[model samples]
Target: MDLKAGWDGTWQEFLQVDKTVFINELISFHSSLDWTLELEPAQRFAWETEYDLMKSMLGHVVRESNTNPETCWVAFEQELIGEGGKRAADVNLVLPTGDLFVVEFKHKTEASEHEILRANSDLQTMLRYHSESIGLVGHGYLVLTKPGAKEFKHSGVVCEIADKGQAPLLTNQLITSLRQTGSYDVLRWSKGEFYRQPSILHGTAQVFFDTKIPTLKTSASENIEEARDALLKLYQHAKAKLKRYVVVVHGRPGAGKTLLGISTVASVARNDSVKQSEPIFLSGNAPLVQVLQHTLDFYGKRKGKDVLGRAIDGRVMIEDLHIFKKHIKSSFGSRKETFVVFDEAQRAWDKASPRDSQSPSELMLFCNWLSSQSFGVLVLLVGDGQAIHRNEMQLEQMLADLDNSVRAQNGNIVAIMPSLHAKNMRLIKPIKRDVFNLKTPIRQSYTEHLDKWIEAVLSNNSALARDVALSIESDYPLRVTQSKSLAERYSVELQNTLHEGNRKPDAFRSGWLMSSHGGQFIEEVQKDKFKPGKRIGPWYVEPPSSDNSCCRFDAACTEFSCQGLELSLALFNWGSDLLFRDGQLVLAEDNRHRRQYDHYTEGSYRVLLSRGRSGLVIKCDDSETFEYLKNCGMRVV
Candidate 1:
C-alpha cells in the first residue's frame, strides 16, 4: 500500500515541528497512511536521461505491497481547516478503511501523567464522536515530537499495539518506512498483563483520549474583565507580600461571576510569579463543579503557540470545596498552591453545617493559616442572592453585622465565617467595590429585564414589574399554567427549538425548576415528582438523550440544587414554599417542615425566576398566586 492523497498545507500548518519524523512515526503505527507529504527518499530517484533506456528495461518497478492499496482522507470546513479536532490535537486522520484516528503531538520526550491524561481526554472525545457519527472504528494515536536524531521513547502503551494479544497495528508501507529509520524492537510494544487493563481513555485503542476539556474564553465582558484584572492584582499582592488576600467578585444572579472565577484561575496558572505551583478551583456547588470539571479535565490540552490565548489548560485542580478538605486536611497549611478560586463562596457552609464537611469560612481561615506556611490568596466568587439552605441562612442571620465579625487572634486573621467569624455579605474587605463587583445582570442573560421584573414582583411593585415584564415578554417568555402536562409539553417545544434538529442532545438544557423542600403538598400540588438531593447534578448535566436528563421531563431541580446552575428553558413549578398573602409574597403557612424565613422564600423565587437562560415558564396551578402573577402581566397560556 502507498500514501497517494496529497499531504497538502493542512498538515503543514497543523504540525509545526518536523513533519517527516511525525509522518514516519504515524505511518509505522498503521499499515498505510492515507496522506503523502512527499515522495519517499528512495522513491524520489529516477533514471538519468543518458538513454538510460537500458536501466528502465532492466529496473522494473515491483509491486509495493501484497495488500491492495486504498485511500484515506479527512473532511475540512471553510479554509479546509480540520473539522473533528481540537487545536491541541495535531490531526483527525481518516484512514483508507474509513476509520478515524485522532493524533495528539506531544513535545514530551517521556510523557508526564498530566500530559497522558490530557491527550487521552481530547482523543477520547473526538474518537467517540467519530465512531458515533460514522459507525466506524476510531482510535487515538500519540506522536512524541522529540528533537534532533533522538528516538522518542514511551515506557507505557503505544498505539502500535492496539490491544492485548493483538498483532502490531503497523501497515506494510509504514513498516518498510520505519525499518529504514530504526529497528522493529524500537517501536514494538509488549502486551503484558499490566497493559491489559486499559484506561478509560483507551476503552478500545491503547492510546490517549478521555476528558472533554472546553476551550477557555479570552474575550470577556467589560465587567468580568475588570473583576479579573482586580483579581490578578490581588493574586500578585498575596504572592509577594506573603499574606492572605481575599477579593470577592460579586454580581447579579447571572452576570458571569463564575466566568470571572474561571478567568482568574487561568490567569493565575499563567502568572510567572507562581511558576512553581498552579492554582486550584474549589466550589461548594456540586453541579457547578461537575460542569466545570467536565469542561476542564485534570490537565487540559497543552498547546504551544498553535493555540489561541483562549485555550487555557491546567484547570485540573478543580474539586468540590468539601472534597478538597477531605483529601488534604492534614497538609492544608503546607499545601504548595498559593492561590485558589472558590465558586459560590457565599453559599459555603458554616460551623452550623454538618460536622463532616468544612465550611467556606473555615477554608478561608485555612487560607489565612497557609499565609505563613506557604502563601495564601483566596478569590471568592459570590453572587447577589440570599442563602439557599437553613444552615447557611441561619448563619447569615446570626452574623447579621458581619462587618464586626472578624477578630484577629495571635496575629492570625480569624475570619469567623460560620465555623469562623464570617464577614457580612461574604465580603472580606481590601476590595474596590467597583473593580471587584459584577453589577450588570447576566443571568436570564437573554433578557436584561428578567431580574428587574422578578425583583419588582417579589417586592410587590406591580407597576414597575408590569412594565419590565412587558419589555422582556417577547424574548424571555414568562408563561403560567395550571397543568403540569402542558408545562412539560411547552418545555419540550422550547428545548426542541433550541436544538433545531438532531444537532446534539441537550443543545440547550431545559427542565423543571421547583421548590426543593416540600412534602405531600408538593407531591399532590406540583403533580410532578422531582429527583431531589444528589440526583440533581446529573439532571442538569445529562443530555435529553439520556433518560436521566432533566429534559426528559421526568426529573426536576429545586432552588437548593440549582442555585448556581441553570437551564436554557426553565419550566418552574411555583411550589408551596411561598404564598400570596396581604398583597405580598410570604413564606408558606405549611404544617410540615417546609417553614422558611421571608428572605429565604423570596430568594428561592429569585433563584428560580432567573434560572432560565432563554426564558421562564411558571407552573402555578394555585389560583391565588396565579391571579396575582397574571395581573402582573405574566404571559398566560
Candidate 2:
C-alpha cells in the first residue's frame, strides 16, 4: 500500500487492538531486556503516543497548504537513507510538499536526559537530510509525546506535540515562523494553516501570563514607597503637562532607585490604554535580566497576545545599551507611544574615551530623543553615583551633567535618596548603647567578661558571628598580619591535630583570618608534602572544630571588617589592667577630598566602640590616651 494508506490502516488497527494486550506486550518487553533492549518498552510506548499526536500537530501544517489538489498525501513508517548511505532513519510522516518529520515517543517514566539527547540526535540527522534535499523536504520536525521537552538545540525548525486527555494539541513554534515567513510551500509542509488551537498551554507559562504578569508590582519599604508615590505623581504630571517629560532620579548605595523604576513601569503597564504599549524593562545584570525575561515570558503566554512586539515575542533580548540604542534608532525611530526603561543608568552614560564619543551616552542621547519625538516620550533615569562610573567627574559635575542633559532636552529632574543603612541604623541602637556602652559602670567591672563573651560568641555561635560581621561596615581598616612561613607551619600543625583527634577536616573550611590592608584572609598551609585535610591559615594554629570555625570568605560582612589575630588563649584573653588609654579616634576631616581616610577612621571608631557589648575592655597602650579615655568615663581594664 502507499504511505498514506499504510499509516491510516496501521493507526486504525492500533487503536482497535485491546489496550490490555498492548500494555502486556510492554511489560513483556521490559522483562526480557538487556542494556540495549532495556529501552524497548519506553520506545514502543513513545512510538504509539507520537503517532497519535502527529495527526493533531500535522493539522496546523495542513491548513497552510497551497497545493493545487488542496489534499496532500501523508507517509508513515518509511525507511530513508542519508548522504553517506551509512545511516538510516525511520520517519513518522512525509508531507506532499516534501517536509521530512522524525518522530520520537517518550513516557514520563523515561530518563529526561536520554530523551533530550535522542531528540537532539534525530533533529540533527533530519536537518542533514533536509539540507541535501534542497527544500524538497522543506523542514524537519521531531514529534514527541513529551510536551515539556521543547528545547531541541539544532538549527532547523522543530515542534512538540502536547497530548491533551481527549486530543493532542500541536505546540511546535516552527509553524508560526513558517506562516510569518509567508512561504506557501514551507507553510503547507509545517501544517501552519490547519492548526488553530487556543494559545494557552498548561504549565508555568500559563500561570505567569494570566496571573503573574498582570499583577506584577515592585517591592518597597516606607521610604521607597514615598519616593515611588512621588515619582508616580511626577509621571502623571508630565503626561499631562507636555504630554510627556523626562525624569532623572539619582542617589547613593542601598538607595531605593530600582524600586522606583519598577513601580513606574508597573503603573504605566497596568493602565488600560497604555497596556497595549507595554513598558520594556532592560538591564545589563544577568540575574536581573533573567528575572525580567521570566516575567515577560509568563506575561506573553497568559495574555495570548504578542504584547512585547513581534521581534521580542517569546524571547527576552539582553544587550548593552549601545546595541539597544541602535535597534531603537532603527526599529522605533520617531515612535513616541512605546516606553523604554533603562535600568543601571550609570553604565549607559559612560563616555571616557574617543571610542565612547561615537556611542554617545545612552542617558544623554535618550533624553535628546525624547525631546525630539512628536507625540512626546517619558524617559526615566534611575542610578546611584557612588557605585561604578566611567568618568572622573566629581558628584557636583555628575549632577551637573544630568541637569544639563535634562535642560538640553527641556526635561524635568527629580531626586530621591533612600538608605538601607539609615533604615536599619535604629535596630543596632540597643546593642550599641547598653551592651556596648564604653562609659557604663557594668563595662568597667566586666572588662574580662566582655573579651571572653566576644570570643565565645565567635567560636560557639556561627549565626551570631555572621550577624556581627555583617554589622561592621566595609569602611573599617583593622588588619591582621602573619609571616608566610609561620602561616604554613600553623596550617600543617592544625591539620595534624584535627586528624589525630579523629576529625575530618575540610580543606575549604578555615577560621576567619585577618589581612593587613583590610579584609579577611585565609590560606592553606603547605607542608613538606601535600596531604589531604591538612591546611593552615591565620585564624587557627590547630584545626578548630567545624562549629568553632566559620568558613573563610563565606561570612556575611557587607557592612563590617574582620582580621586574623595571633593570640595565646583558646578563647579571648587579655592582659590585666585593661585600660582605655586615650587613642586617637581618627575622623575624616574632609569628606570629598579625603573620603577613603574618612571612611576608614569613622568605621574604625564604630568598630572599636561596638566591640565591647557588655562593657568597655580598654587596654592602655599609651598612658596619655588612657587618661583621656578614662576621664571621658571609659573604664580602664
Candidate 3:
C-alpha cells in the first residue's frame, strides 16, 4: 500500500480497537459469564492492576460478583444528548428491581483521577435517565485483574478478575428482573474529568463543517461574479509576457491586502497546475507575521489538501524575508515560475544611505534580478504609503521605480492601478472627525468632545494641563513632546521606574512609527529606549508613563526632534526667539544653530498648512510669531 493508504489503514485500526474495547466492557458487565474468564487477557490484566491500586488507596467494600448475584444486570451502550445534541456512554444496565443504571466503564490505567471524576459528572445523561422515570443509577465500574488485600476509596466500584466468574449469572438475573419490571432508572457517577467548555468545542467542530467555512465573495467591480473571474482575467492579460512586474494595490488596513496576495498566488497556481506551492508571504514585523501564519493555517486546515493543493502545494510558507532570504533561496531555488509575494513591502526594505551601504537591500536586489532575467514574476505591493516604516525607504523607492515602469509599459497607469481605500471605509468604524474623502467623513458622537480636546491641547490651557495629569482619561489630550535626547533619558527613567517597583512596560499598542530621516533617534526607539506614543506632524513622541511622570528632556538643548510624516505643532524653548512669515510654518532651515522661516507665498508653505488635522499648536517664546500662526488658522499653544 502507498504511504497515505497505510496511514489510513492504521487510523481505521485504531478506531476499531477503541470501539471494541468499549463494546467488550459493556457486554461483559451484562453477561452471565464469569467476569474474570469473560474478559480478554489484556482487560483481565488491567482489572487486576486497578483492583490492587484501589485496595491500597481506599480500603472500601469489595465483593465478588458470584457472591452478590442480586447486583447483576444486562448492560447496553446508550446515547446521550450533548451540546451538539449527541454523545454516547459505554453501558446502560437494567436491574431486576426495575432500576435502570447508566454505567460508564473506564479503563482506569489510561485516565487520571481528575479525568475519571469529570467523566462521571455527565449531568445531561443523568438528567435524561431520570426524566425517563426509570430506576436510574449512575456508576463508574473499575474492572481489575485480581482483588487486592489493601483498599481505596474512589467515585465508583472496583471489580477484580476473581469476581468476573460471577458476571454472567448476575447479569442474567438482572436482565430477567428488568424484563419483568420493564422500567429502570439509576445514574452511575465517576470523578475527576474535564471537558473543554461547550462553546469552544462547538466552535471548533463548526470550523470543519461545510456551511461554516467562509467563501471569498466577488469584488465590487463590474462584470465580476466571483474572485476567480477577476483572477482569470488578470492571468490572461499577464500570462503572454515573461517579464518582471510589480502590481501596486493601495488600500487602508483590513482592505484585503493579505487576502488579495493569497488569491493572486492561488490564481497563478491554478493556471500553472502547480500542486503544492503556496505564496511566500514576507513581512518585517514578527508579530504581524505570526498573525498571518495563524490565519493562513486556519484557512488551510478548513480547505484541506484537495482544495489547498489546487491553490498551491500543501505548504503556505510565511517568513520574515529580511532574515530568511538565504534559506528561501536554498530551498526554492531561482526558478522563474516560483512566485514571491512581499507583504508589508514598505517595511521590508532598508532605508540607510546607498553610499553607506552595510548590507544589500534584498527587495531592490530581487526586483533587479527579476527584471534582468525577464521572468514572469508577479510581485504585489500591498500597503498604504501612510503606513510605511521609517526604516524602509529603499523599498518605497523601488516601488516608485516600479510605478514609473508600469506607467511606461501600460500607457495609462490610472486604468491599470486600482485603489480600494473607499471600499475599506465601510468595514471599520473610524475615530471622530477622521475624513476619508470629504463627503464620507466619519460622523461620531465624540466629535464635539474630540474637537474641544484638540482645542485644549493646542491652546496649552489649564485644561491641557489637567488632561495631561490624567493620562488614561477618556478625553485624554494628545501630547507630542519632541526632544533629541528623549531616547536616552526615557530609558534611564524607565529603569528607575522598575527600580521603584513598577512592572515592565506593556501598555504600548502596536502601530507604525514614522520619521523623515534615518538616524540615532529611530535606532534608539527601535532598541526600546525610545517608543512611539502618538503622532503630531513630523514628530512621533512617546507618551508619558503615567500622570505622575513626564517626558525627560535636556534643558540646555535648543534643537528638538519632531515627528516625521507631517508637521502640526512647532515648539520654541523658553527665552528663545523664533520668526515665522505670515501663513508659513517656522522650521530650522538645517540641523544648525541658525533658524529661518519661509513665507506662505512659497509653495512649501502649502504642504505645511495641510499637515494639521484640525489646527496647529505653536509654542513660541515671543507672542508675535504665535499670533501670526493663530491668524493663519493655527491654534497657538
Candidate 4:
C-alpha cells in the first residue's frame, strides 16, 4: 500500500546493472495511488475525471488493492496558514525521502496567470515550512488536466500541461527535480536584495522584501476592476464598430489610482481582443515613474533577464508625461500602441498664454492628437487631488479640454470621482450621467475609521476628530511629543516600529515630515552636520548619502516632495508657521507658507500624516503650540 514512488536513492546504484534489470528496478520504484469508487470519492466533475484517469493508469493490480486495508496515506484536503492568510493544496505527495510534492490542478484548457501565482505562493509556503520546520524538500507541480492547456514558464519553474493519463509521470519528474535540487523554480524573496534605507527622516537602511500580501480585494480595487471590465467591454464594442471613447476614473489621495491605472494597462495586455495593442502608461510624477521603472530593472537583475523581458515584451511602456508629450507630437497614425492610460491626469497642464507661447500645453495637444489621429482608441484618465504645484491643471480644466472641438466629434467623454459630487465638472453638459465615482480607499493599510479620523484631525474639526480618534485602534500609532529631545527619541522609535510585525529591518521605510516653512531649521541642521553639504532635494530621489543621524536629521521632505508615496513610519515636525489655538488651526503672522494654508495646509498635513502606514510621531517645537495641541485631545507623549 506504499503509494509513494519509492524514490529512495536506490536507483543511483542501479547504473551498473543490466538494461533489463535496470528497467525492472526502475519500474519497481514506481508507486501507485490506491483507486476505489469510495476511496477518493471525487469531489467535483474534474476530480472524477482525473480519478478515473488515475485508475486506468494504475492498472488492475493497484485497483484491486484499493479494497484492502490501506498502508499509505496521501495528503488531501490540506490547508496551511501563511503570514498573509490561509492557503490550500489540492493534492500532495510525500516522497520516500520525506520530500513533499504538490499539484495545483486546473481543469480548463489554459491555466491562468493568477492560478500559477497561487500555485507558486502555495509552493513557496510549503517549501519554506518543510525546509525550516520538517527538514524536508517541497516541489510544486502545476497541472493543467484539460487538453491544449498552454504551457509556460515563470521565474525558473514552468506550467505543466498534461494530456490524459500523463499527470502522474509529470508529478514523478517534479518530485525528482526537487530532490535533485534543494530549491524549485519560483520567486524566492531574499533579504538585502531589495533594501531601501529610511529617508533623512529616519536615517537607517532597513531590508524589506517586496511581498505584497494577497488579501481579499478591497472595495476600491473591486470597483476599479469593474471599471476596467467596463472599459474593456467598451473597447471590444469600439473595436467592432470602429469608434472611440474617453473613460475618466478619479479618486482621492491614497485611493490607488496609480496602481489601478498600471493594472489596467497590464490587463489589456492579457486580453485577447486588444492583446496585440501596446499600452502606454504615462504619469507626470517623475518619482512615481522612476520607482516603477526601477521596479522592472531591479527584477530584471534578480529574476532572469529573459524571463521578465519576455513577459513584458512590447506589451507596456511606462513613460514620463513630458517625454510622452514630446514623442507624441512627432508620431502619427494609428500605430500598434492604441490604448493610453494617464495617471494623475489632473496634473496635465493647459496652454499657458498666446503671447507667452509655451508650445500649447501637453493636455490640449495630446487631446487634439488623440481625437484627430488615433482610431478606435480608448483613453483612461486616472486623476487624484495631490496637485501641490501651481501650474498643474485642475480636473475642471482637463474636462474642458476633453469637451473641445476635436474630442467632441471623435469620442464621448466621461468623468469619474471618489465621491457623489464630481468636483469642478458642473460646467460640462450632461455631467450627471457621465460622471461616476469609486467610494472605497485601497492604497493605504489604514482602515476607514482611521482615514476619517485623519481627515477630521487635519481639517481642524476638533470635536469629530477627537471622537473618531478615541474610538479607533490602528497599527498606525500616532504620538505627539512636546520636547525636541523627546521628538528625536521618537523618530528613532518610529524607525524601530517600522521593523515590527514580521517586517525585516532592511524593508523598514521611514522619513521626516516637515512643513515648507521650516527651511531655516533644515538649513541649520544640514550646515552643522556636513559643513558644506548641499540642500536636501526630493527625499525620494536625492536622499542623503551619509548614514549619520545628524545628516538624516536635516533631510526632511515637505508635501510637494513626499506626496504619492507611503512610508512605514514618519516623524512629523510641527513648526511655528502653523499652530493650534483652542482647537482651530491658526496660521502665524510671519507665515512663509504662501500656497493658501487655509485651503491646502489641511491637505498637506493629510498627505504627510497618512504617508506613514505603521505610525506617525509628531514634534511640536513651540511649547505654547504644543499645549494648544494637547488641549485639542491629540495623544501627547
Candidate 5:
C-alpha cells in the first residue's frame, strides 16, 4: 500500500521516520517479559508505557502472524486529523483483507466515561480513513490493560487481558482470529458518523480561495491588482518607519477585505523581512480558520511542503484571536510577531463588555501590547458592521478619539474602502483621514448592485432596497415565500441545481438557514424531524443530515455555522427574530429564541441572505412580514 498517498501531507514526513529499531525494541521488551506488569493492581501504568505496550503487541502480531500479505501493516501513534480536532490511535493494525482495526489502550482498571467517548470518536475517524484509503470500513477496539481488570460492555464491549501469561501473544491471537473470521464489528456501537464533508468555495469565498500559488482566483482583474499593489505600498511604508501602523480595511460583506488581508500576508512571506518577524493572519471565527487552514494545507501538500510544520515555524500563521492573545501574553516584554492581519476586528469587545468583565477588552489589550513593542509593528484591522452580541465593542467604539497618544507614537490608521463615498457607508469620517477603496465586489456573483440591495434590505430601508432590487442583475434565482412547503421544494430544486446532476459521492453542499431559537417550530413545520440523537454544532461542522420516511433533509445550518463558509443555495427560514412592519424592520420582543442583540439583528440577516451565490429562497412565516416584502415588489412566490 502506498501509505504516502493515503496519508495527509502533514504526516508524510513523519511516516518516513525509521521504526524498525522501535519494532525490534518492542519485540525484545515483550519477549523478555521484563515489563512492570507485577506492580500493584491499583497502580496504573504510565501513559507512554501503555501506548508502547499496545504498539509492541501490534508489531508482535505482524512479526508472528501468517496472515494474508495485504493486511500485514502496523502503525504506532498514528495521528489522524478529524474535523473536530486531532485524534491519534495508540495502535493501528491493517489486515490483508483490506480491514483496519484501531485499538485504544487504557492503563487504568476502569476507563472513565470521557476516555470511552474519546475512543469512540477515534473509532469514527479510523472508519472514515479506512473507507477513503482502502475502499472499506473498519472497527475499533478498547483494551483495558490493568491487572485483573473486568470486561465491561456499552456500545462496544471492553476487553480485559491484563497479567495473563503471555498476554500480548494471546491478544494478538484473538485479534488475528477475529480478522480471519470477519467477526469483529466494534463500529456498530457508534453507527459510523463522519463529521467532515467535501466543501466547495463560491462567490467571495471562492474568489479568496482562488487567489495567486497561495491564491487560486482565475481572474487577475484590475481591482485585485490595484489592491495588491496598494497593500505592497503600505507594507513598504510600514517597514521604513520606526513607528507602529494601524490600517483599517472596511468594505461591504463581499468586498474582499479578508482576501486582501490574507493575500498581503502571504505576499509578505515571499520576501524576507528585516525585523525577522513573520506575518500572522488572525480571526475570532474558528470556522474561517479551519477552512483556510485546510485549503492551504491541501495546496501545500501538492508542493511537498509541510504546512503544519510551517505553521509551527511561524512562516505564515493562521490562528484564532484567542490563541493570538495567548501568544501575546506568553511573549512578555518582547514581540515575536511584527505584522498581524486581524479579521473581523469590529467583533472585539470593550472593557465594559460582559465577556471582558474580568479582563481588559481584547482591542484595548491588543493596542496596548502593540504600543509596547520594541520594534515597528503593523496591524491591519479589517472588519465591517455593528456588534452581533450585546457586549461586543463595535469598531466605532474602539476607534473613538483616534487622535491620541497612540497615534502620536508613529501610529497610522487608514480606512480602505471601494470608494470615498461608498454605498455600504460604515466608515468613520473624522478618524478615517487616509482612505483606499476597492471598487469591485469580488464575492458578488452578478452585478455589485446586488450587494447594495442587500445593504438596503438589511438596513430596513425598504424603499431603497426595492429600488436597488429592481435594478439588480442576479446570476442565480431569488424567491421570497410564505409557504414553508414551497420553500422546502425550492430548496430541493436549488440543491439539485448546485449538484448539476453530478452523481459523485459529494459534489456540493446545500441546506436551510434555520434560526437556532425555534427548534420546536421548525420540527413541526419541516417534513423531516431533526435527528433524535444529534445536537447542533457551531459553524465549522455540518449538522447531522436527517432522513424522513420519504426523503432526506439536511439539518438546518445556522448563521454562526455558515458565517465564513459559502453554499450553492440557501433556503432561509426567516424566523420571528426580525420582523417587518410599516416598511421598517422590528425585533420580536416576545420571541423566546432571540439570542443575538438588536444591533446585530440586521447584520445577521444580511450574512444569511448573502451566503448563497447561486440562489436564495426566503421562507417567512409571518403574514405581515410576507405582505411587507410583497408590497416592496420582491419576487415573492
Candidate 6:
C-alpha cells in the first residue's frame, strides 16, 4: 500500500528529517495479529466493558513476533511505578528482534514535563523487562501519538532516560495490555502540501507535487525569503550567461546574509535547477564555520545521512575559505563546484607571495580559469565596515584583482555589489544593487536606525549620532556603566529574559565581548577564553548549564574571535585600544595596535557595538571614556 503524500519523499530526502519511519511497520504489525476471542464468561465481562474489540487485537499484535505467543498475550500485567503513582503506557511494542518502541497515546494537545518523564520511565521499565527476557541491550523510542503542539521530547533534554548500553531503570516489566493516547508525529511530518490518508471506502492517493524544502532560517523573516529569491535569480542569470561572476551580498551585521547564502544553496541542492554542481559554502570565520558544519552534520545524523561526511558529489560541503583555497590550488585541473559561498569575504587574507597566488586574488583567478572549462559564480557574503584585519582585502581590491585576472585571460567578468558600496566604486548600478543587498534591520527589535547611529558615532559626528540614538534608544537600549560587575548583571538579566521566551533555551545565546588588547593580563587566571589554543566552538554551541557556554559570561571573546557572531544581549568590556580622544575616535597611546590604520580600529568597535540583538551594556573602566561615551548619546546604567 502506497500511503505516502506528496512531501513524504521530500521529508525522507532532506538531510535534517526526523527518524519516524514506522507507519508501514505498524500496518504490517496489525496484519500479523489474529482476532480470535475464546474468552470465558468472567473474562468477557471485564474485557467487553470498555475494550471488547481491543482484547483480541491487542493480544494478537503483541504476541505475533513471539515464538511462545501465549507469553505475549497477557493484559494489564505490568505497571510503571512513578513518584506520584503507578502508570502504564497505552501501547508498548516489545520485540526481542524489533526495536523497543513504546507508543504512549496522549489525547491531550500538550505533553507536560512530568508526563514526558512518566512516559520515559514506563518505556524504560517495559524495555528492561522485555529486553532482559529477549537478552538484547538497545535504545528505543517513546512515540507519543497526539496531534499536539507541546513537545518536551524534541527539546534534546530527556529528563529520566538511561544511557545506551546500560541496563534500563525499571519498576515492573511483566507483559501488559496496551492503551492509546496519540500525537501523530508521523502524520504531521508527512502532511506537507497534501494529505495522505487511507479511506475506508477508497484506497490511498499517490499523485502530487514534491514538498518544497524551505530556506534555512536563523530566524523567521520574510525579508530573508525575498533576499533568497533574488540571490537564486542572480545565480540563475550567471548560470545562463556561463560567465565568471563576483557578486557581493552585503548587509549590516545580523541582516541575514549568511542565512540567505545557505538557504540559496539548500534551494539549489534540492532542485538542481540553479546549480551545475553541489555548491560549496566557505567561510574565513573559524567559529562560524565550525558552528555551521557541526550543526548541519549533527542534524544530518538524525536522518542517517552523512550530509558532510564526504562533502563531495551530492553532499553539502562547508569548509574554511583558506582550506578551500588549498583544494583549488592542489586540484588544478580537477572539476570543482561552480557555485561557491565565501562568508566574511572582505577578511580574505592578502597575497602571501610576490605573485599574489595565495589570496582571494587566486579565487578570482580560479574563476577566470573556470570560465574556460566550466562557468563559476563566487557569491561573497560581506558586511558594511566589517574589515578589521590589516591584511584583509576590501571591495575595491577584490574588484581590481577580479578585473586584472579576467583581463589577463581576456575573459568576461560580471561583478555585482550592494548599492551601499557604490559610493566607493563607480561600477555598482542602482538597478543591479537591490537584487544583491539585504537592508532589513534584524539585530534587535525596533532597531531600524541602530546602524545609522553606530555609523554616525564612528564617523565622529556627535550631533548626528545623538539625534540618531534618540530614535532607537527606547527600543534597542545601549547602556554604559563604569562598573564591570554591573554590566555583567545587566547582560545576564537580558540573557535570562530572552532565554525564558524559548522552550529550548539553548538555542538563544548571550555573551561578553572584549577587545584583544590587554586580554593577556586576564588570561593568566586560566578561565580565559582569549588564551592561545582555546577554541570557541564549545563556547558558542554549548548550553548555558555547561561551563563552556558563552552565556556563563566567564570567558569573554575579543572582536576578532566574534566578528560574525551575534548575541541575545551583549556585555562588552571596553578595552583601552579604541576610545575617544580630543573629540575623535582613536586607539589609546599604549595600545599594542595603536600604530594600525584608523579605520581598522573603528571597524572593530562597529562589530562589537552591533553584536547584541536585544540590547548592549558596555563596561567602560576608564572614567573619562565612560563619561565621553555617556555624553555621546549612550544611555547610562
Q: Is candidate 2 or candidate 6 better by lDDT?
A: 6
Score every model by TM-score. Answer: 0.55, 0.31, 0.31, 0.56, 0.53, 0.58
**lDDT, candidate 6, residue 439?**
68
By TM-score rank, best first, the candidates go 6, 4, 1, 5, 3, 2
> For each candidate, C-alpha RMSD in Å?
19.4, 25.0, 21.9, 17.4, 19.5, 17.5
**What lDDT does candidate 2 reach at residue 595?**
32
Q: Who wins the TM-score comparison?
A: 6
lDDT of each: 0.48, 0.35, 0.33, 0.50, 0.51, 0.51
- Per model, how many backbone clashes are there? 19, 37, 68, 9, 16, 10
Rank by lDDT (best first): 6, 5, 4, 1, 2, 3
Residues 1-637 of candidate 4 have per-residue lDDT tens digits of 0122222112222222344543343234321212112222223454445445433432332243331112112343344433222233555544344455666776777754445645655555455343221344556777777787787776523567776556655545543443442332111111001111122122100001221211123355466567666666766675676555555676766555565566556555555434456666777766555545544544444444432225433214666676766666666452346677777777777653334465666555665566554344545454544556656766666666654523344334333333333444444432332323555665333446667777676567767766665654222346788665665566555443221222223334455667666434453222122355432222332322435323255556676656666665567788666676665666766657545535566556666667765456688877766765554456776
Model 1, 1-637: lDDT tens digits are 0112223222223233244543443334222322223333432211011012211211221133221222323221101111111122434444333344554443334544334433444443343222122333455545443332123333222433212211133233232332232221200111101101111111111111221112112122555666667667766766687656554555556566665666566556555534454677787766566655543332233212211234433235566776665545555544566677777666655542366465344534444345445456666666546576655633343334223233332333323122223334454433235566566653323346776788788888878888887766534567888888887777766544322212333235777777765433232112122533335434555556766567777656776667766666788888776777778766666655254555677777788887776567788866888988887778776
Better of 3 and 4 by lDDT: 4
Residue 527 of candidate 5: its Cα lDDT?
17
Instruction: For candidate 1, give the lDDT.
Output: 0.48
Off by over 4 Å in 6: 1-227, 230-244, 273-276, 298-316, 349-360, 412-433, 444-448, 459-464, 498-503, 518-534, 581-584, 591-595
Q: For residues 498-612, write the lDDT of model 6, one tens digit per residue.
A: 2221223444566778776633423311223356643466666555676767776667777777777666567788877867777776777775746377677777888888777
* Candidate 5 lDDT score at position 101: 59
Better of 1 and 6 by lDDT: 6
Tell me model 3's lDDT, rounded to 2 decimals.
0.33
Cα-lDDT of candidate 4: 0.50
Score candidate 3 by TM-score against the native. 0.31
User: Between prediction 1 and prediction 6, which has the larger TM-score?
Assistant: 6
Task: Please write out the lDDT profile of model 5 over residues 1-637, one tens digit for every residue.
Answer: 1111111111122233344544444344333332112323332233345534544554455455543323245555454433212334556555444465566776668765445545654555455333333344455566776676666654532454566423453466446653564433323322322222223322222223333422212132245456566666666665676445555565555556676676666656555452355677887765566556645554444335432134322224677676777776566454466677887776765652355457756665666677776444444444466345555566556554222324333444333333333233433432332334544455433536666667777676778767766554223456789876777776555443222212321223445776555334443222112435223222212321323211234345555555656655567888878787766877777758566565566667777787765457788888988876655546775
